[model samples]
Target: MRQERAIRTRQTILEAAAELFDEFGYEGASTTDIITRCGLTRGALYHHFPSKESIAVALVDAQSEALKAPERDLGLQSLIDLTFEYARRLQADPILRAGVRLTVEQTSFRSPGSRPYRAAEDAVYRQLQLAAQKGELLPGLDIEETTEFIVGAFTGVQLVSHVYSKRRDLLERVSAMWRLVLPGLAVPGLLLRLRVTPP
Candidate 1:
């Protein structure tokens, strides 16, 4: 019974921390704030999480895992749909948006050796390479360079969207990015129509 209680307590602390961190950002939030929000003592928070950085890592880990689901299918369309869906969710969810914002704004607070990001990046690279091998992508395109470009472009769009808009129409922005990028990367006459209609 005590073990179960401890697990519940830890979950509660993590949940509360996720909410607070998402709402207020990393530097904006403090340990006392989380403790107050969770109605738990600092000791309880510490017992569950060694530090704020740990909580951030946990949140990123969870998000990254969620992002990995599409890689299992190993299809180009599946990957694109999954990524777009994730961007849509991030745009809609304040907590997610805040997390992304925190990661981009506060580089020093981010985990130094985060496995989640690296794993996700590797999965994406593998998927692209596989597509190239199967002739799904254009011939002669450097798989490594293209993967890096796509990842950087997607991250840049998310950051720019967060800065310029309220994220209500992030899908539109993502679509715009796709229209511009996909045409170049895709094989001639094979660029799939973007789902996001122009506003």
Candidate 2:
């Protein structure tokens, strides 16, 4: 049970750090402050995370890990489901929200070449390629361009919504995003088969 307790303690630290990072950007949230927030001693915090940058890296890893779509057949719906699920999680999960913030807003804690963003793009690209193979993508659609667009549009929508209303309308904005983009991405019959409003 010692191992179990250690795991729980580590998770608590990460969660507390995420909350603080969400409230104040990465540079704003200090390791000393995080230890106090988690109600743990400095030694305990150091045992789990040697430095504040490691915590940020952990959050970025968590962000990429949380973005996968639920298991489903390879098709346009899979792509839609992946995006909608990520949107929903971003709305509800503070950890993920904070992770994205750290990835985007951190200046001092510069990671190597925006790994989190690349991971996000890769996840979407893999699914899009599968959809193409399954005959769900529009004929002559450039898979690379489509993948880039999916990641960019989603990121832009979330950033804009966060600025305007702190993401209170994220789901609605994502739904509207799909409505506008889906027509160009799929055939009419395929569009009819997809659910633009969240899966």
Candidate 3:
């Protein structure tokens, strides 16, 4: 029972920290803010995460695991579903929002671990490679380059939506992004079959 309570306490701290990081970037968020947000003592917060950076890393790791790619038939739909699935999560999950924000600032943090960006890139890369095998992708499109481009584009779209609309229009923005990117990536024959919106 004590162990379970400890697990819950750690989860609470992580979530409160994520919320602060989402509202304020890494530099803006402080341990005191997170502790106040969680309504937990400083000792409890430090018990789970020694520092704000540690809390940030924990959020990144947790969000990374939560971002499982949606399963789909190996084709253009697979890639489309992958993007929409993550976009859906981003719209709903504050922890993921914070994690993505941290990933965007990974270079500035200069801390250990590859973080969420690498995980997202790897997931997209796998889907792209599968599309290549199924001939769902455009001819001569390099899977690695295409994966990086799609991931980068998705990141840019999310960032723009967050900045301009506070993510209130994120779903529509992601749908639009898929519409613009798919025609170039999906095979002409498969274009009509791939739906930009959630499946």
Judging by lDDT against the true structure, name the best candidate: 2
Reference-based TM-score, model 3: 0.90
| Model 3 pairs whose backbones collide | none
- Determine the C-alpha RMSD for candidate 2 after optimal superposition of all C-alphas: 1.4
- lDDT per residue (tens digit) for residues 1-199 in model 2: 9999999999999999999998988889999899989999999999999999899888878987776766676467777787778888888887898888877773888754668778888888888778878777789999888888888899999999999988888888988988999888776678777787876
Q: Which candidate is the best by TM-score?
A: 2
Task: lDDT for model 2, please.
Answer: 0.84
Spell out the clash pairs found in candidate 1. Answer: none
Worst 10 residues of 2 by lDDT: 105-114
When 2 and 3 are scored with TM-score, the better candidate is: 2
**Stretch of 10 with least lDDT, candidate 3:** 106-115
Q: Candidate 3, residues 1-199: lDDT per residue as tens digits?
A: 9999999999898888888888888888889999899999998888888888888877777666654666777556776777777777888888888888887775455554565667778878877887888888889887888778887888899899988988888878888988888878888988887888877
lDDT: which is higher, 1 or 3?
A: 3
Residue-wise C-alpha lDDT for candidate 1, range 17-50, written one tens digit per residue: 7777777778777888888888998888898899
Instruction: List ranges where model 2 is wrong by over 4 Å.
Output: none
Report clashes for each candidate as comma-separated counts.
Answer: 0, 0, 0
Question: Number of clashes in model 1?
Answer: 0
